[model samples]
Target: MSLVDSLKDIHLSILPQDPVKIDTFVFRLHYFWTVSFILVFSVLLSLSQYAGDPIDCIHDHNIPDDTFDRFCWVEGTWTRKLGFDAIGGQMDKAFLRKDLNFVRCFDESTNSDGKPHEDCWQHQYYQWVALVLVLQAGCFYFPRYLWQIWEQGKIQSLVSGLDRTSLIKGLQSKNELQKGEIKDKIQLMIQYWREAKGTNNLWAIKFYICELLCVLNVVAQFYFTNFFLNGQFAQVARQGLNLDENDSILPILAECRLTTYGSGGQPQLTSGLCVLPLNIVNQKFYSLYWYWLSALLVVSILALTLRILQITSHDMKKFVIVYFYRIKEFNDVILKRSNHGDWFLLIRLMDNMNDVVSSLFLDELEKIKPFEAYRADE
Candidate 1:
């Protein structure tokens, strides 16, 4: 069958009748649902910004109408002659400035032409940041997908059967015939457990692989995000803050100016600049990245530690039970009963058998043994 079909079947089969009893820690710790929510939020934020123009040119307000019109006409004609767009059309073509030098805003006293304009650099970078957030969310969820694909099916099957058997055994207590059937089922379960023990190492390896992926995903996010932000104006913000690369936090908003050198080697004001338009969105997103990613890292570490502890504890318990059974068999005294009473007790203890099933099996064994003893006495 196709993977999608198998996943659908697994999801349908694992739905618990009593939802309260279902353990959701695995789902939550896997981080798929949480990351998916973040992805959706980022997509919506991007769409909202897309509905309006993110960048617009800020024209110089100090210019007089007649002089400004003549100046614009001359500049526009020259720009068109040079194969550049008209001044009005230039407003729509605002791209991120690639240089490190800041622009100067127009000063009416120092400059003759009031030609300075500003474009929204923030708008351009914010879109990229939004895309990065989506990618980060996918990284958070990929490990969970790996687990579901590799291990979740086997885990769900085992847990489902255990739950079903426990429920049935609980309900069958008053009926002798049903109790006998449960006894047979318990024996089959014990045999399955014995066979499953041989593959315990294989299961442990699979579990560890998923655990490692979870850790690696968090580490990759930390470095990848730092690289992405630094590559896109984060370094410029750091320089503005007078902080080194290591000490600076990612800035959501910054202002810069674009200047051109005049013939006299004086800096002429060309444009006033505002970088990163969606400041609120970026601020919230980065704040969440700092807090949420840190918390997730801690939680993932703790979850992995707990899983390792659980596996160790389970292995120790199994070893102790098996050692005791071996010792009992070596002594041969447990074999004196000759009616499999001791064998049943050992199996029940070693396999972590249900108390009800153990009691029913012991009671039936007692009844049969006493009848055989009476017959021998006669």
Candidate 2:
């Protein structure tokens, strides 16, 4: 016996007398739930922005900010910032035509001068947009809530139904039972456990995707906040410049009796228009929205991490047991077998493992706080 043999002996000494593999059906269900979350959330976060006015939906919060090419088109890869004074392409023509056609039609119907019609169009457009934004936001949230409820129930069912110890004991007793009976019982149990393990992994993957989307949202939000701010400020500055161009500082200065100092006595300013409307709305809404979005992103990230930890922890435990057991089993029952076709030892080891795991199932699962509460309450 060399180092390998010595190590194998050490491993066998530490191995549990009985070790259980995760239930396959439970694992598969977990994976399904996770995959469902990924599909649902990915669609919600990525596509909701397009739910509203296709032109302005790019600005909607329904879509996760992190997604690229969904917003105003850029030549390179996806980016958050709505860059360019105008979307420089034929698309701009389409937008301008659409804007002008609607505005002109409204102006004609109202039969009013340019200013009032513009104001009316602005009000109507913004109000319609606000409604659309709200509806788009709903598309993402409603499905997720419903799925969470459904998953909660299914997880409970899985926890309650699994009886691996009984399953293993039944399999062990098959030595005296009919060959067909034994095969059926053992195969069914193995199939179920295998599926359960797959489900767990699937869920873990979905949680990971959710976390990634959350990170992307944070980045997107940051860019959108800046984009909205700059546009608002630029609009204000343009108005200010127009007002200054119209008014002469010399006259105001003379009226206020400050002309005695110099020719450039005062700077022109727009009275009662200290703030731009959109700028104010942007400042107020974005700050509050940012806080809320950040909180949501953090929650999602934490949920994903917790899910991954749960799935991985179970896997790690199973691996540790299998790794050690395979070595010991190879040296003992496997090597001593007269016929290579006699896999009885392997079958017995698997059954024993299931028995051990089934015995401790609830106790180990309860360590997961979310499930613990649910189990206790249920």
lDDT of 2 by residue, 1-378 (tens): 875575456444533222233212222222233233333332333233345322221222233423322222211111111111233523233223332222221222344232232212111121222343344344333433344443344333333333455455645432433345434444444444434432443443343454455445445645553453333423333334323211111000100000012357743211110111222332333344445455655665665554444334544333423463432111121112112111212232243344333223222323434444554655
Judge candidate 2 against the unseen true structure and give its global Cα lDDT, from 0 to 1.
Answer: 0.32
lDDT of each: 0.44, 0.32
Model 1 stretches with alpha carbons more than 4 Å out: 1-27, 61-124, 159-191, 231-277, 313-378
Q: What is the lDDT of residue 267 in candidate 2?
A: 30
TM-score, every prediction: 0.49, 0.28
**lDDT of model 1 at position 364:** 43
Q: What local lDDT does model 1 show for residue 266?
A: 86
* Model 1 Cα lDDT, one tens digit per residue, 32-111: 44575566556556765577543333446443434433332223211101111356544222222322222232445654
